[model samples]
Target: MANTTSAKKATRKIARRTEVNKSRRSRVRGFIRKVEEAIASGDQALAQAALKAAQPELMRAATKGVLHANTASRKVSRLASRVKSLSA
Candidate 1:
């Protein structure tokens, strides 16, 4: 459907960007899931570590435009609180 050369190029760029974004999103979700698993297992130490590791990944996703800034902040805040409540 992209008749113009510029439109075709733009479509290609969008496809590439979509793949990259999808990968990033999946990676971020994996990190979040790890943290959740740790929490569910009731291993405070592991949960804390996973939360620490995930914080940066979540923030990075937001920076890369994969997630909204406020959404990331809220997630980090809630996770941090949950981690804090866990005994050492």
Candidate 2:
């Protein structure tokens, strides 16, 4: 129960932010899934392309505070490595 006017306003703001964050998180996940699917399909070219596309999205999520910077970097690194291995 938000008794004060300010508290009520903050609650509304939080709800709005939560929705936005959820969308961003989902989008990031979708990008990662695309890369993984490409990798799983054993298409090096598609996996490379997917990883290329996902890198920016992951970084954007990190910059926007949806994910930690290192976390995003780690994901990109791991995915890139896996994609690269498909070349060998």
In terms of TM-score, the best-performing candidate is: 2
> CA lDDT of each candidate?
0.94, 0.97
Each prediction's total of clashing residue pairs, residues at least 3 apart in sequence or on different chains, is: 0, 0
Report the alpha-carbon TM-score of model 1 versus the true structure: 0.96
Over 1-88, each residue of candidate 2 has an lDDT whose tens digit, in order, gives: 9999999999999999999999999999999999999999999999999999999999999999999999999999999999999989
lDDT of 1 by residue, 1-88 (tens): 9999999999999999999999999999999999999988989999999999999999999999999999999999999888878784
RMSD of each: 1.1, 0.5
Give the TM-scores of the predictions, in the order they appear. Answer: 0.96, 0.98
**Model 2 misplacement above 4 A:** none
